[model samples]
Target: MLWTIIGIIFVLWLLGFLFDIAGNLVHVLLVIALIVFIFQMMAGRRKG
Candidate 1:
């Protein structure tokens, strides 16, 4: 679930990086993905 979303974001980031499209919004996606990753890690730590 989370992996899928992260993968999508990563692909978009790569595309934006290569093509220089999306007008800086792609970096926003990267930030969101990082935050999501951090939150998930924290949640997993709490659960375990």
Candidate 2:
């Protein structure tokens, strides 16, 4: 689920790069997604 969100956001970010539509918003979401991905990785590592 988390990965899905990250993937979707990443796709949108790439689309923004090509189309220049809502580029800023997509970039922000991409950053948020990256932060969440990092946090998830950290939590998973601790549990394992």
Residue-pair clashes per candidate, as listed?
Answer: 0, 0
Candidate 1 lDDT, 1-48, residue by residue in tens = 999999998999999999998978999988989999999999999999
Clashes in candidate 1: how many? 0
**Measured by TM-score, how close is model 2 to the native structure?**
0.94
| Candidate 2: tens digits of C-alpha lDDT, residues 9-45 | 9999999999998949999999999999999999999
Q: How far is candidate 2 from the true structure (C-alpha RMSD, Å)?
A: 0.6
Q: In model 2, which residue pairs have backbone atoms overlapping below 3 Å?
A: none
lDDT of 2 at 42: 100
Where does the lowest 10-residue lDDT sum fall in candidate 2? 21-30
Query: Which window of ten consecutive residues has the lowest lDDT sum in model 1?
Result: 21-30
Residue pairs with clashing backbones, model 1? none
Each candidate: RMSD: 0.7, 0.6
CA lDDT of each prediction against the hidden true structure: 0.93, 0.94
